[model samples]
Target chain A: MATISLGVFDWLVIASYFVFVLGIGYYLKRYTKSENDFFLAGRKNSAWVAGLAFLSANLGALELLGMTGNTFKYGMYVAHFYWIGAIPAMLFLGIYMMPFYYSSKIKSIPGYLKLRFGEKTRVLNGIAFAIMTLLVSGINLYAMALVLRTFLGWDWDVSMWVSALTVAVYVTMSGLMSAIFTEIIQFFLIWFGLFLVAILGIGEIGSITEIMNRLPESFNTLWSTSGDAARNGMEVTWPAIVLGLGFVLSFGYWTTDFLVVQRAFSARDLRAARMTPIIASFFKMAIPFIVILTGLTAIALSNDPGSGFSLLQDGGQVNYDSALPLLIARYYPTGLIGLGVTALLAGFMAGQAGNISAFNTVWTYDIYKSVINREASDSHLLWMGRVATLVGVLISIGTAYWAKSFPSIMDYMQAIFSWVNAPLFATMLLGMFVRWVTPNGAFWGLLAGMGSSFYMFLAVKFQWFEAKILTLSSVQSDMAVNFWRAWWAWLICFAVTILVSLVTKRQEEKDLVGLVKGLTEETLGREVPFLKRPEFFALLSLVALVILNILFW
Target chain B: MASEVREMKSIWFLVGLVLLVMGGLVLLAGVVELFSPSERQTVLADTHPGIWWGAVMLAAGSLFYFKNRK
Candidate 1:
């Protein structure tokens, strides 16, 4: 594609979005008068709002750029991240897991750890989470800034600073509410913009079948990628996708990640809170159409010479991340180009703000209040929350510079998940379900799991071991390697926790009742009126998921 | 439903209003591009994505805006 220039209209569209974000923060500032208000929006969000925020919070540049690039690189196998990887986990969180989380009334996942295990587990997880949140924020900041510089010919640092300052100001001013409010807007912008690309690209290509016909046979099938590494474009087999990504990594993210869970925590009531993830699942089921299809379209365009995409590098390798922007420039005219760019900016900002907001809450409630000042006033805590948001964004900016070392933003993120999330999820699963799992078991299990995952990560990335356990021949790509690492790490944590729990003292039954599954009765209490029942929503999402899998199979 | 709406603050109304305006501007732009003969070939081929997407946004924004209007 030729050097694309933005018109006055495009700048206006982006500027207006920024102004609207700042304006929302200013308007909501007064409502954030207390710690509860600042961190949880006083638990006032309705189901629809919370659900949108939940989906939007996760729909940042990671989904826009990272997933799109991965889809371009890996083909249909990348859709697993949304479908089998996310949908079931989201429903499980809503239908079964959220009651423990909501009823326990803890502010962060680490807070729940303190109640279930002890200070050791809580502090260890809390510090790790806080650091991880900052790293994730930095990854998002770096990814967005890089994409903007590539697409618009803007200075990288300038793009990074502008985004960081915009997110920081509103987030500091109105806290989580601002981040969420902006996220809802972003949700719309991103969908519309992505829809524009998908619809136009499909029109240009004639149909999904036509596009598939033009691409390699390996790129067309989702389940068929497993037979041989040489044949599978993704270098991942079905077992890896099902066991590694679908079971461990997916559940780890949707069920436990405090960044996304914070949206549900902000819901007005238990029903709405539970409904949040379910509603998000419905949207999650459709995301592949917007993201994955665009990547496929870019792949089709790149393979056909004289198609004007120009995404190929020196080694016959596609600059996979450039797929989204190249598509935008290819199809969109001047005015629609503005909307598309706004959508890109919206996704970037939403991701940054989501990370920062989650960082603030975890810092204030989990770390600062619990460790540094146990008896601080709510007002003082609220002040600390603002400070944490500022500090978090600054640290993220530094991390963004560090993040440049990674080959791709998505690879860095999946590696982090392997190290932190797999172990954390194992602990969460045992802690919430198995009442006999002692505090010592949970704490030590987490440490063992995280340590082992990190070691295996280094092993895989460096080809450190000749042993089959250390070397993965089934998976061909670094991304697939990360997935299998998470799987192994989770198993270690699960085993260690069970072994340690049997020898250690268990918690009192009274203390564990509402916090553990099967130990509590009707945790959700009343039925959710037929239409809003989680099962009904989950079933609908599941049906759609099955049909999508079949259609693409 | 009423109770749910009652809990909503003005910030949501602002959300709806912003979407309505943004969608309206985008829809107008799409309409202009549709009418302009010179821009037709250079734009998205045979697809008026802006108008269609703008209408969707208009509907979505209005739902958020008017649902809490009372």
Candidate 2:
């Protein structure tokens, strides 16, 4: 492995990219006319910007850096991330859940709840979603800082603050519009930069086929069929993969996560909004090649971890966050190395900015407007949104720095989201269609779901529930611990939501039709036509792409 | 009836193609072992299933790419 320092060429390309993105922020600043314009990009962003934003948010360095490292350490079952976990869930949400939000015409997702349910449900969702943004923003900013520090020896505080402030300035300056429009530039660099790293890396690995020829027989077992232990401490046993990654993580993220929803909510029309995630879904299916390849390549070049590479763990684990940047600095040539850095930075900003911008909007419109100051003027609300974004960015930076103390940033973020996401969905769905779902139901469901899940999380954290839970004897390793806990968390939250909602004044629980029918001032009601011709064309192309994928390998 | 049969046959062809690839990959693994047996790879093998999976993904993806629409 070679250590190539960042040269003048690399700096120039990266600095140029930064200038271009800031320029986009400045250019769009003037067009942000009213509160709507500032908040929602004047309700006019195209599919390309929306699509890129959706993808870029997910495309964060977390996956490129962290998941790539996982891929390097673990085998290819990482593909299950998109295939089993996200693809189906994405398509399902696009067809089923997205239309519910997009057509309902809510400014943000929780705003839709206010219309369908009551104010309490909206605020609960708003606050829950806001907390999610805080966690996500923190992780993303932390990751961005880590990438720079690992590469350039930049100070953590300086790196985190520089990136966070840039994102906040633009987002505060505009809103989703600024964040998304910048994504167009960011995604390009991320792809191009990653592609460059992969090409050079494969060459270093002594051709794709030669590397493939040396692979373990078990690695080819599509589902970890050979029954091996996950190297980097993942509790992915065989059956757990069937239920955990395949079911819960997939269903939970696609069905409930608002990062994707915010994108859907931002689209210009139903079709664009609906189809954007589907397109991004399929596009994501290709990411393992780039992210995972960089990971494995890091392994091949570093030659089993203990070689003092510092980038890789001796136990075949690469520092999940450093894998991508280390590879770029090690393998890529001068100018390209700089480009790669820019791209990784772009990936980080894309996630951090989207999180901050979204959290700010949610706080201002959903929680602040409804609960704190119901009579705030449009101008005042708009100003608060901008202020919230700035504060959100600062909190995110602080949290990112704090998260460094956690053992695994990736696992920590996922675990926290799991505690909250499923339960929130319970409240949301019941409030939507079940008109009789009382405001009390909303209140109690939030309390119970959050309370029970928190208790379950703590119980598992302390191993307090060892008496009743199932053991991992069948799985061949200790992998089932995380899976069992994930299931229990979602289950307990969901059960609490339903029981609390059903019993706490059933009179308030309105029927499904009446509640949803109340969601719009628009239509006499028409089902979103089964994705018009263009969308179907996109779907078919996506399928073809999948089939081609299977055949090609 | 003819169109249905045609579609069905193509579906099976696609499915069979998949089975063939899977079997080939398994066979390839066997060949690698028979040849290498005791050889430890020092050159760093990038054989993480993801690369090959990415290629197979092209097949899975083709199912989604529609040609029927304008």
Candidate 3:
């Protein structure tokens, strides 16, 4: 941990935003009038809020630091992973998959499975989703902890607890609506802060050409058609990037993840939900530019022959993830550094608490009450939701510290979660599209998917004892770094689900008319009443005003 | 309604096929790299052209969908 110094002004600016977030959290408390209000923002919110929240949730600490490290290391491959991989996935989601959830009026994805299939399928899907949601909690908490340690030099325990406390407080108090509003504010602060640092960096270094001239060839290694990241059966070539990053990351996110779906579920209507992510997709496209650019600029700045990038220590190879914070601490005066540090907190807490709140509501309403105890009163349920919030925060904070002991915790967290997610996604998509996908068929198929992927992941990830029965030694290599073979996790899961569904002759398919109830009629206006043009124009105006950075000071 | 639904479905199939193709190729390349660990870097560097191909197909598909929507 670095011995950090912040000026009084810096403290004030950082404190100001904290006050602002708390203000929003306290302010939105009035809106949490019921379980629905807390869970889904009363299902009457504007698309823009949903859109902003969706973007903020996606713009997690991963991009703040991990993507910085990624692009700094991999360069354009990171870009391809997004434009080539993620966007099209979102578009696919916006059109084809979203309708199923909206039309069914299901609270959680697992709930939808139960309705479409049966309780057996529901429990399977629920378990898988729970695993993924839990894994993600670990990943986000880990990153938040990292930022706090690097920037503020807080002890791991202190950082974890503070990060957890901030999120737990606001989330338990006000729920998703507060998370959204706070995110919109935090979203602006983070970019503004990052952009400010980026500008300072470029200005400090003088010109782009001057900056570019200072780097080694590796920093700018553009393409590698011949793959180099493959070590001992593990690989991450362009092909792998396309498959793992583009396909896996994209499809997995858009189709399966509830964070964004929760936003869509809360929208005024299906149209608003659809439009929200479109707006978010555009924002998603722009983020890597801001984040990656700041990181690259730090690289260029650090490469100036004698500039050791030692963070005041002896020259060290600049860890690109630390670029944003180091820059904030290095150049800004004390008070401004305070503001910058606080702004980084904005990015950290926005995603962290958002995940916690979503976790609480989903677990309480969808799983606990629905399955564990169905007859709880609303008041009891609300209290249970708050209790879930507290537990979710504690678990995430524990994970944040626990990750310190793991191998490349970020990557491991993502890989494990994908196993949970890949299975459920396969089953859900099949259930939606295939007519003969009977409830019984779906139940077993989903089980097969989860079982196959989990077996694959664990069989390789943990090579427990092997020589108990065989003549071999009692240990073997855990060869699970098979990024390449991991694709089959999805393939096997999807194929098995479909095969099992088709093999077991189910009863005749349910009628499709009910599913297409609102499709043909020009009920876009009636079904989804949006703000009139003037109101939309005014919303745009507010957004423009918020981005006062672009035109004005 | 039938016409629009047909158009959307047709495009969906077209796009899905292209995605599946691209996905297959990537999987092939990934499989190749599993045995050739060091070759992983070179494989991903080769993805831009494939990405470009996917992008072009996506654009063309979107155009087809939009053109028919009217």
Candidate 4:
């Protein structure tokens, strides 16, 4: 494996990125005077700003690299993650969920829980979310450092510390405002830096049709081979794809996860908030052109004997994650290589910033202000938000070092999401749509859902029971087990909430006015025409989604 | 008066500034490489992607910068 050495021009491009982000943070600091500004970017961003930031928060370098790598491994089936797995949930968030979330004026998702359920459920989710955010943030930091060290021969400790410190300074300066600003910039940098690889790869491969023809039958079609697990690279049937990834995991993360939803929370009004995820869906649908196409191009090149292209192998195993970096090394010269590296660096820092900002909000509003100091002033809480940003970054640094020691921690990311978001989605769904859902039911049902998901993960990992029992299939992939486990967890949470609510007392309808669906008054976009509504855009996104699936099928 | 006081530079303007600076540098490097090519040429060095891509960035950056420039 060759190391990617940065020349003077490359260094300049990278240095410019760092300067701009820090400068933006310094500039926004004065305007970030209020708690709302610190926590939610002043609630003043347009739909476009919030929308790109919303998508960019989740579009980390690890996702870029890993998805491209997974495409090389799983073929077109990996597109399920971006398409059926994400777009539907995003549209659902904009169309059905944003009204409740935005209208409540809650600082965080946990704040909404406190209003709808009780203090117990809110605190439980707050604590869980805070832990999950730090762990994921730290893991991202570790993975970023690892990628730099492996590909560029950079020192791991330096990579980790420098990137972490940079994120700390920017995020602590103006909190979510700086985070959103950097994320939107990162969005542009990624498209400019990485999309070129797809274009160049297409140039090398002659055409997308030629690239598709070079692949084995198992790797080409999206849904055609999904009927039987044996016929596809993913080794899972359509049911698992639809139920697990599309419904449970996608809805859970997109609608409920505060990291992305907080971007929408920053929008100036309910209409912009609703439009945030709707606009984001279009971009999210387009990302596969960068990742998936480049991956198929990698496969096409490797299959050609005269091309002399092969993935880097470690310990006799082919490293799929090497696909994107190796492609950059193949196509990009000096100046462009620097741009590509900076794009990856921007991604790592923005993702870390997103997590830390989300953590600070949840810790300050949901935990500190709610439980530690109930009558804290706005200015004081704002101060605590900055302090929490520092503490969160430090904890993430510790987590990164821990991940460095145990690299296997990266494999547990999907499991961690299942434990937290899967069950919480069920509770959120019931609590919002069903007015009869009691606070006690939400607390207990969430606890059971999280517990069951974790238990199932451990049961499969340790071989306490055969995984077939959970997956209900003789042949299974790690992804298959993950989807089925999430589905089961969500179902358990849904059922338990219903049963517990039957026996327990519910919140009064008057008290649940803005939080729950039936009790809340619907004030959709009456001033705007039907064509300009979020619903119309969501319908268009859905139609695009259907056409894409059918075309690929 | 209140509106004037509250006005701030949009995020797009900053995005444009960064792109313009970086794109200019890349284009500069590309032209230098064109006259005296680097010893270690990449797989498709004959195509000189840096020049074209840099020009594209410059064009896009200029559009964003001028449109949003207050």
Candidate 5:
């Protein structure tokens, strides 16, 4: 067994990265003098900045490492995450939803839900979102620690705590402002580091064709293999791809998750905010080339006996999670290794910071002030925000350890996302598009949706069903469980919301203005310029995605 | 009018400054890698990423920094 160690230069690079990030946080401290500044960056970020942060906030170890590993195991089928799953939903958010979010002047998604549904619904969502963010924060911390323990051979606890403390320091100081600024920097580092690995790996393999020749024919194609569950390198059928992930999970995350939407909310104007996710989708389209390609290159190199590389664990099986780290240690030299590892560290920290910051905002505005102390002053709220950041980080550290109990962390995280996000999005979609969805309907509907999802998860995992009722032919076990859970949950939530709304009194039409789809035409995106029209960009993004799919196919 | 112009100028100046600093460091790393012997290069790594990407960054920085300079 070979061990990869960091040299002095690597330490210097890592140290400098820490200093630069903390420096940005300290420098931005002056801007966060008020509660508004702490939560929303005073709504001062430009569209490009907001867009980059929007993209970067999601560019954590989950997307980078998890997707890379999945691509290694699943082949081109994994591109579904970036292309079909993300692009259309992001465009929809920018075109249709941003107007409502920006015009409403709401602090969080729960705050908006309160306006549309009622207080109980808001409280439920706020608590759910808070718990989900902590879980996600823990995933980032744990995944980074896993990678560090694999490469540098550090203790998991040490790696996890050190990473958490660094993120806690910056986020607690200047709030989201600091997280956004550092995310912009981390975005660049992640790209530079990944691009270097991709170029080198592709160069080694000779060409895309050369690399493709080494893998099975199905591995090179994306959509074609997805038609059959068993034919695709991964057992993801087109139905599951199109509906469960592309429709449900993607919309749930890009549209409703406060972590990313909050970045869009910090934009300077309605137009800028509208442009944030659209611009991100453009970059999101290109991410797979660097991320997924690196994984494929690793597969090709590791399979060749002469390459002197194999990411195999005991019993000569591939440890998919170690794909990216193994590639970094194999390809990059001493000094450059620092930059690559720094990029990974930046990704981990930025993700944790983004989660903690979102958690702080939701906790302070949605939970703390609304429920705990309604009469708190701005200064007092600001202090509470900092306190929440600390608490969020500590809880996340504990959740990081708890995450070890799961067999596959990525699958577990996605399953949790499916449970909460799908139902919340169903309620959100109904409340936003249909004005008649009463508060009682939405509240009970969300509860039923989440409840059914939880029951389905337990039933499938424990083999409670004698027959294969929940099983889908084309989808694998864990993902199949997730997709079915989300699909049924969304259905139950939608049905319950509609059923209960029929029994309850509806809100006045005047009050529904700018909140529902049909009523929002005047207030939403009334002044989009020719160049800034979201439809134009959406069309362009879709075209690019279609072309990539065809080329890969 | 002068103040608005000054504000825009400052924004661009800051952009240029950040670009230059980041680009310069990357370019420096590239130059060092460029001088290393060919034997030191690995098959699994890019032969000249530091130089290639560094030059690109340098060009972008120069364009932004020098284009609007007094």
Candidate 6:
């Protein structure tokens, strides 16, 4: 229950961040005259700009705190989220999927569904995505307020309202351009602010090797103990890790999530778009060095009785999320303390902005313009996008209050992803690769997939069936259940789509060109040499990924 | 085709400016704290990380600012 007091220098650092973001927003307003500018940042960013924004959109403070906490709980197995769970999907998206997405020039992912499937499928996805986005955004706001109130002694209402208003001001001004700018800044702030903890922790622990030596066998090695469910802290097997987390859930989130994909859509050219996620993959691989190492350091510190270090516990339950903030309190001086807090604040605000920006675009382009106002003008749609931004933030605030009343809702975030994105990924895969996939097939398959995933979650939650039946293991963690559920949902969707496609009428080959794989021409980065292509970098990224996994194993 | 409008400043330039200002402030605080240390010290306060890390930020910020400044 202790709070860290900020010095004058700390306040300065935090205030400067607010000023910079607001200034950036005000400055970019002129360039944001058109709907393209608001929704897609004018599609003029380089690979590096789009790449960092892509990664930062997903790198929220909640992930930082939770991952670091998860590390303290699950040990090195947590690194799987950053590595196998992410890198391959990112590479797949960049090298394979980006071409179709970019060439079609769709404003949002559901827009692509409309072109490939039908209006019903597009509206179905758009409505699901819009609801899912607002709920997650609201949860993020609640989590941010909780952290601020718990750690800095800030008022919860004030924290929520202040952060929400700041995001609204900036995003409403220039939209995604301002969002991308702030996201890039947040990327730097996170590195400079938090990477120091890993360094200082190593300084405290003597060495990285010493920290590893102090951990239990269940907590240190990544894959060595993953074969048997009983051998690891996560209580899951390698097959679960691979099929569930590594394959289905990973591909479902990374390849299909619009929050991240919107950044790639902002790239200036086709090659840049392809390279966006490829460039992000390298950085994604490096994040574990910050979160995983710090988690390991926390384990090493807590294990020593005389070190006088321990995690906070509330209501007799251990608060694992307190690890990173406690480390900041332990090592950061006055000035650096402010920088650390600012880094976390920037992360929370930028993440909220990313969600709202993506929501506004989907609302304006996919739902409102497509369903409600089919003949809306460019200027009218632009106006609608701004209104959506304000309304989205207000709904997010309302959702935050709702979450405050029922804290257990936070536990359902993974379940929500499985419900919406997992099945949608199956629909996307078939729609993109299989030319004979019918609109009816996609629509029915997606609904069945989403419904089944939700049903599976509720069944296990209410004890309608033993969770062991779903996980196929006697020992199960919530995380293990999530991974397995995503796999089943994807499998159901994938199977149902193929079955229904055979029974349904297919679209003409002419209508499928540039959307489906076999029908589309392979003209991506053809003029560029091997060394300059995204494939070369993706190969390098894959090699790095393999090496890191082997080294950790 | 030469136009009179000034070219828009790059996002990198803005990044550099924010880092430079924030880093300079941190470095200044670190220097002041080095001479007149706070009574409530952190775990490794004797090592003075604020000073060095602030300097690193300042240097990195300078490089970014000068390189990208229009």
Chain A TM-scores of all predicted models: 0.96, 0.87, 0.83, 0.99, 0.97, 0.99
| Stretches of candidate 5 exceeding 4 Å from the true structure | A314-317, A405-410, A466-468, A521-529, B1-41, B44-48, B51-70
Q: Which digits, one per residue and each the tens of the lDDT, describe model 5 over residues A112-157?
A: 9988877889999999999889988987888888788877887988
lDDT of 6 at A41: 92
Worst 10 residues of 1 chain A by lDDT: A466-475
**lDDT (tens digit, per residue) of candidate 2 on A1-553:** 3334565556666666666557667766776667777666655545544665677767777767767776655545555665655676677666556666776567787776676656877887788889878988898887777667656777888888878888888888877767776665566557656775676667665676655544554433344342544432343555566565556566666666666567666667776776777777767777777876666666555554554344644357545556776666554444445656777888888888778877878888888888899899998988898899889988887788778887366566666665666566566556555555666766666667666656766676677776135435433232245445456555655566666667765542223333453543434224546455335745764585567446423
- Provide the RMSD of all predictions against the true structure, rounded to 1 decimal: 2.5, 11.4, 15.5, 1.4, 3.0, 1.7
Q: A92 in model 4: Cα distance from truth in Å? A: 0.9
Provide the global lDDT of candidate 4 against the true structure: 0.92
Q: State the DockQ of every prediction.
A: 0.37, 0.02, 0.01, 0.55, 0.24, 0.53
TM-score of chain B of each: 0.74, 0.39, 0.43, 0.88, 0.64, 0.85
TM-score of every candidate relative to the true structure: 0.94, 0.79, 0.75, 0.99, 0.93, 0.99
Q: Lowest-scoring 10 consecutive residues by lDDT in candidate 3 chain A? A: A467-476
Error of 6 at A479 (Å): 0.4
- Native A-B contact fraction in model 2: 0.00
Interface RMSD of each: 3.4, 16.4, 20.3, 2.8, 4.6, 3.6
- Candidates 2 and 4 compared by DockQ, better number: 4
Q: Candidate 3 DockQ score? A: 0.01
Instruction: Write one digit per residue (lDDT tens) for candidate 4, span A95-133.
Output: 989999999999899999999998999999999999999
- Provide the lowest-lDDT 10-residue window in model 6 chain A: A519-528
lDDT of 4 at A383: 94
Cα lDDT listed for each candidate? 0.82, 0.62, 0.59, 0.92, 0.81, 0.92
How many angstroms is residue A319 displaced in model 5 relative to the true structure, after the best TM-score fit?
1.4
Clashing pairs in 6: none
